[model samples]
Target: MRMMTCRLCGSDDLTGVVDLGATPPCERILTADQLDEPEVTYPLHLRVCTSCWLAQIPPLITPEETFTDYAYFSSYSASWVEHARAFVAGLDLRPDSFVVEVASNDGYLLRHVVERGVRCLGVEPSVNVGQAARERGVPTVTAFLTPESAQAVVAEHGKADYVVANNVYAHIPDVIGFTEGLRTLVADDGLVSVEVQHLLTLMQLNQYDTIYHEHFQYYTVASAQRALASGGLTLVDVELLTTHGGSIRLWAAPSGAPSQRVSDVLAMEKAAGLHDISGYIDFTERVAKVRRDLLSFLITAAEEGSTVVGYGAPGKGNTLLNHCGIRPDLLPYTVDRNPYKHGKFTPGARIPIFEPERIAADKPDYVLVLPWNLRDELIDQLSYIRDWGGRLVFPIPTLEVV
Candidate 1:
């Protein structure tokens, strides 16, 4: 196999960050009948470009294969919905302002825009989720946002005043083209807000579970600035957010003066040794510790005759479960709020998924939380488990029980 160039910078100088072996697509929940057949897996090695500092993986899986009828619905989490609502409250928009959200899953964000009477459209690629958005009265077009598709959106709804691509920037393999698509979607003076998991947090905190096939690239503010400039967009400001463990929200436009926060985050990345790829060297060790710690905990618990189940079947959870080589025997079953996943199984772990009510009925001894990023919210929701001497466990960063 030939060495592949960096997905964002076109640099041939790609170096290893961590090789997560091979994992099945995290969102490809399997039916009982299909599990008996052959299952597919893809390489999940993440690397950094020496030239531009963008961390990425091989584009082994295409967006269409993973997102056509996607399993992730954003509104299932009450906190995430409130996060969207709060974000909408801050945006400077009027009733006449047109808004567009790329990869808008289930219209979780844009429904707030509709509530404000702001003209809005969702360019969602997932057919099932797009229908859900439409059913909720949020106008949606079910297609990927390529340059041409962006033009189609403009032809119908005019250029948007605000373009929001929350949690979707890292999903595309064609980073440059997708950035250009964002530029094409917004007017020259309009703004584009992007929220992607921060590479700095991914390293310092050991968030290796976010390194699935769907997330093709990870960005520091420096690399993100370069990525924005690739499509004639300029980063004006950035906000450090707690979403997805830790994320950076970039505010960009065709032209603008950069803000102090941009320089501050770049400086933070520099101080953290991420500016020149030195920080990536020890990451493999950190990720290994997480896997070992969780396995040790689970094995000890199982030996003690404790019932261990999982909470929330998020994509990041799939990466952690597969990397740790966890099987249904150890984890037994996991519960998710989305009914779509009720009878399905996780991609590689093959742990059965059930509705959220299963935990209350069974009163398991421990519930290993897969989506630890939503720590506070999940802790509050699952606090009732304490009534029956049940405890919540988190796997990533560190293994902790509360």
Candidate 2:
């Protein structure tokens, strides 16, 4: 694939900061019958824009190919459900208010909005997830969010009072078009809250596994502000979140919205050297250390006559496993709560995925928590592993056996 320009700034002056070699499409888990088929892999190379300091990968895969018939279901996660509930409870909503969620996966968050008697709509590209949302009584449009789609939504149901985009910002390749949709769909006095994994946290914690083809852009406060502003939205508030390793919930609106905490967050990012290339220089080396540490741990466990299994079949887990060259010989099999992925194999690594019961049945010596961002939650759920003297392992940031 040819190298492309930056998504945010449209600048050609991009520097290669980190490369994870070639990796399979993160979400394209396969069934056993298809294992013998040839699978395509793309370069997992990340580039930083010298002008805007936005860390992104070239859009090698189109949005349609990535999101259609998606396998990720948000409602399977207990903590994420509670997070959605808390967010809904905090919202100052009335029965008549309109709430719209972009990339609303299976109405995981909008169900709360609907239960509150508020009118809610979900815009999802994936047909299966969008159908699920509709079956749950949430109004859903099965299409990607673009300016044209946003205008149609506004014309049909009127402008939304609150637009919530959680964890969808990073997946957008056309940042301008997606943000334009936000601007077009929102009311004059409407509020928009976007949650994205903070680039600062990704670097600080060595969470390089989060780098995937689907995640086209990684944003800092400064880069996010620039992208939003380009689409005629102004950042108003920024709240740091502990979810997804770490993230920033940015509140935005039309030009006249109050700047509640935007300046403070920007200042913090600038202080952390996110405004320049210096902050990104040592990231490749840090990521390499994580790869080495994880492989060493897994190899040592195998040599000592212990078995190591994985806990989750997340997209990030695919990146980590493929990058570290892990296969069934090392991890054997992993498990996930999502039944859609239960019978499938992880892309690239082709590790078989089973139900959570398999972990208890196998009684492995170590359970590598692939989704380390949810380490606390997974540990609680799989605490029964401790009954058999099995420990949990975290690979990113550093190797930790708990």
Candidate 3:
């Protein structure tokens, strides 16, 4: 709604692309009493900056507003905690090592480091989650991450040896300020690792749902290098992670540090066309194809009097369901493996959530795999649906029956 400058390239030259219509925040699930009131909506439009090649939505909300009352918990995914633990173990943490996590929720990763006799602190913005982290023995600061907050953290816990920010890199509106905080918090020799969903994957896979108000910028390694360099840091290493389709985990230190994976991965991205706008333009066409195919399949199914139910209540699922403009009329309900989301309602579409066991009783003709990123895992979980003469539908990348 406000001025639309690309956060990555600082370019004011942007063109309007796809619009997903007016919708509420995907995580703001409403109760029965709150359904009658009007909801806030921002321009859910995608734009490409001609200068920077960054694809992003408008920054309607600041980082402090977005993360201060965080709802999505990292521990919801089974593999994420293990991923965090492995990171700690690989870092060679010692008893005196001080590891800090920015935007730590529920002490998911810090607990592992703390158990190994290493001192740990979580700089969580959400009061509810910050309280939970403290209760679990993770020393936490219940405030936003800024230069001021970083100084306070250093005063309280000394300089950190390892600072991690998994999947929170894209959430910050002030990329320069956040990286500045990282510089202030981490010791000169310490490392700062940040994980963000690869923009290339989103383009190739047509994962339009990953674009939300909370995510200020979609990052590629190139964009990350530029942002980090602004704060006098350099991306020294990078790893291609399997989480969230595919992501880049970057290891940064002061500029001119020796590392193995920096130039190779940057070359890999450049070789794969990450630096050019043509790559994104090609992807826009592919995404349009997916949108067309997905709509056709859903419309045909409904016309043929088919029963369709979705599987997985993942945040990405909310994005897919909302972007597709699907409601209970098109997909009546969805089943989830996580008990916390079971019996809850989806945010925008208000689709009913049920336990995975409900699939047996309902016997829907097709179970749309909402979390298509984990297609294999979800298919394994719901393989029994085939016994009842049902099929699985994967809607992203393309609409296909599994």
Give per-model TM-scores: 0.99, 0.98, 0.92
Worst 10 residues of 1 by lDDT: 2-11
Ranking by TM-score: 1, 2, 3
List model 1 lDDT by residue over 151-203, tens digit each: 98999889999999999999999888899999999998799999999999999
lDDT of 3 by residue, 8-94 (tens): 668899865456666667666555656667767666777767676666788776666556666666666566777788887888687
Model 1 stretches with alpha carbons more than 4 Å out: none
What's the C-alpha lDDT at position 274 in model 3? 66
The digit string of per-residue lDDT tens for model 2 on 1-402 reads 555788887789999879999988999999989999999999989998999888899788998998899999899889998999999999999879999999999999999998988999999999999998998998999989999999999999999999999999999899999999999999989999999999989988899999999999999988998889989999888899999999999999996654647777777778877788778889889998999999998888899999999999999999999999999988899999999998899999999999999988999999999989887788899899989999999997899999
The per-residue C-alpha lDDT of model 3 at residue 402 equals 78
Candidate 1: C-alpha lDDT: 0.93
Best by lDDT: 1
Please, what is the whole-model Cα lDDT of each candidate in the order they appear? 0.93, 0.91, 0.79
